[model samples]
Target: MTLQSVLQSLLTAFNSLGRSRKLLLIVLVIILLLYSLGPRLFGYGTYKHRYQDPNTACMAQNLIDFQSRIDNLDAFHSGDFADAVASKRMAYVGNGNIAAALGSEKGLYIRLNRALSQPINFWPVVQTRIEGSKKKSTVLDVKSGLAYKMQVLSSSSGCINVGSQLYAHRSRPALLVQDIRIQNPSTLPIVVEMDQIRDSGWEHVEIADASFTINGAETVKYKIYSSTVPLLKSDKVIAIAIASVSIESTTERVEANSIKKFHLLTAVHYTQPMLAEEAPKYLPDCIQQAKGELEKGLGINEKLLRQEHTHVWGKLWYSGFSISHSKASGAINGDRINRTLYYVLSNAQAPLHNVMSTQQDKTNIEKILYFPDNCYSGHSTLKSDTLWIEPEDESQIARVVTTWMITLEKLGCKLMVGAVKLTDPVTSVLYITSDHQHMQELKHAIHVKEINEAPAHEHHVIALHKHGHHFGGLPTIFWVSIALLIVVFHLFLFKLIYNEYCQGQERYSRSRYSL
Candidate 1:
């Protein structure tokens, strides 16, 4: 058929249809048009969103590592003591140069090695005194920082005595003395005494001092002392004295041994101010602040506070970590600063104080996935000023996951973990950054099983691919289906109209003939 004739025939058949069918045809055409142009006309699709801040990812990873290290308590002492030694060495002289006052650095290292293997007492010096004959005192010149002394007294039985004392030194900053060495130049038997003040009188405290003594005419003796002393008070000092306890009477005057030529050698320790300030770099502020809060909350005295601080620090020195980014001129290391900020936030633990309370009915995943309008105020990223959530029970993985997910979701993030058994005590699930810049990172959470057990887990995750409202436009398949339906419906209507019209014309012709 010619184009014009075909068009005319189709139009005539369409006109034969009822009003309802025509309306349906118009509706289908509109639906098809709307579906095709929906994205441009309406502007809708799944919005790209962030479930967590990529910037703080490295800090979180560091915290996880630190927590893992601390969770293993048996290794705590050695790690902490080594850090303490290194920190002290750094503070005293610095990394480049070791102070001559510390005596032989080699000897110091050896003593530190011994400290690692054995229990060592460490204390800060309060005040040091060198005493001679008849209560006469030898002086340590402040400028030179050196001490010299002579024999205090010799008994009728041939025993000589000398004294060196340590009281709290008020002028200097507080410090922890890990080990001390006193060198005796003469070869003779030497006995050292440590007298600690008690309620009644001065009492002898038995100490294991590594003594290097050789019995010869001019035998040289070396004495090593170590103490893990309590935190030194600002004003108080403990007294320590060393004297010669001879096994037998020696009438022979060995000038070097008899003169009592001994040097303080070295005071091995680090200052307290540095210790307190630098603690957060290696230890979590939450744990430390929690200890301080306990002290204040319970009205703990200095003695108790000291005990608690020592106990807590000894156990966990792991803090969050920092990763360095591209060096900006004079920019503080972003990773270090973020780690510090993480600690501060972790200790704050006041999520809903001024913030809106979260709805309880929401599932843990929903709680994480949704964000309120005001939640992102003042920050480009979702603001979770108080992101820390205390795990309800360590034994149950669900509790941990739920708690962490809720916290993360509040910050506009989601987490996925493998199928985890709640009963596995050693299994741990944590979120971490893959790199320093926190990009191209895996969206999945890590499930870590204990080294000793069989691995049991399934990959489970809530994939975060986009942000904003999830629906945008109809798919290509949907559009194709609509087109097919419209074509089929229109064809059905045209056939019906054509058949009905033909039947009517025939009936009319037949009736006229019968008349």
Candidate 2:
């Protein structure tokens, strides 16, 4: 059939339908058209429609992506930048009882405590000197409990790459491990020196050559030993021992276009001498124990030790909480949060059962003082007549107010008076502890009359104004309900039209039969 004839036939069929059916057909067509065009017309698929802000959506997605990965760019620092060198401070690595704040360039700061303590710089624990190389980059792999650094050596004779991985053993809190790999890419051999320097407080420092048989071949190794004097005349003694192994020779050498690996394990032990006089007697045993720990750790495969360490860290990280932001600085904020958590985790150890508390005695509480003009005091009070307002100061005040309320509640104080007047300069004050006679004493001391309570309605209005209504605009639920209602209405209309068409058909049939 021709296109015009087919269109005419369809139009005739549509016209022959009853008014109710025709109306229903038109409504269905309109609904279909609207449904097809809805998303495009209303920007339903846009990020703004879904998330309200594109920046917030981007940040949320970035956080999610970071959580799924084992490593992130935030954990890496390129040594080529000037800031990298300037910002080189120690990053913490530890297993609950013992921790080390290790610097990217140099320094190993150690701490021993059940909880986080200030790390002591035991500089020169293990120093690596690559012949003619500079540091390339540093990576902190929090998931693997490892810190990595790369160094590049370029000379007219050859080019070489050196990498080092450092970690504190999770299971063995006193043990720290470092693995060095030398990659020589040119037709020339390179030599690297490894040094374990003794700190000032340590006494009886010794270095010895040792050998270990690996894969039925004897490997040359060296040990450096040191012990600290009795801690402040106490019976305790801290001894440290380091074991170093070179896969090839006493002097670390990487053959032309080949790789060589080196291993260093440092173990620490503390002697629990019962009497101060016995500290000397315990020193030998402490040194032996530290050496024994190093030996035990060295026997284990490096890969297995790394796997176990990473597993422990994985569990800790999984148990910890995560905070995310929706601002433009969300990634930076997330990185900061992660770093804080990492440092805290590095200083935490598994809690021991039946352990005695070592906390000092609580200080006695004397009097609670309130200083209304404290914010305006100090340099500002002396220098200027005009009042200056800062957002940071306001935030600090809010925090202080919150802390004060918590403190009062903890001290069995009942809030008897709370008032805020937003006139001129704005005044806010709180009076607590009506149950104690201190309130009267305070009133007398301040020479102030009793405060008159504001009307309840006025207070209510003020509260409402301060915390403005949080109406969340139109939500998904509202739109969903509207759609459902529209569907139900269409269904009812279709049923009504069907019933009318059936009745009309019956009447027409009867009239035709009577004729």
Best by TM-score: 2
The all-Cα superposition gives candidate 1 an RMSD in Å to the true structure of: 29.5
How does each model score on lDDT?
0.30, 0.51
Q: Write the per-residue lDDT of candidate 1 for residues 121-217, one digit (tens) a residue.
A: 3222212222232222222111111222212333333324343321111111111111122233334544443322111212333232332232333
- Worst 10-residue lDDT window for candidate 2 reads 377-386
> In model 1, what lDDT does residue 504 have?
82
TM-score of each: 0.18, 0.49
Name the regions of candidate 2 deviating beyond 4 angstroms.
Answer: 1-74, 78-82, 85-91, 101-125, 131-135, 153-159, 193-195, 198-201, 204-216, 229-251, 272-276, 326-332, 351-515
Alpha-carbon RMSD of each model? 29.5, 15.7
Residue 387 shift from truth in candidate 1, angstroms: 13
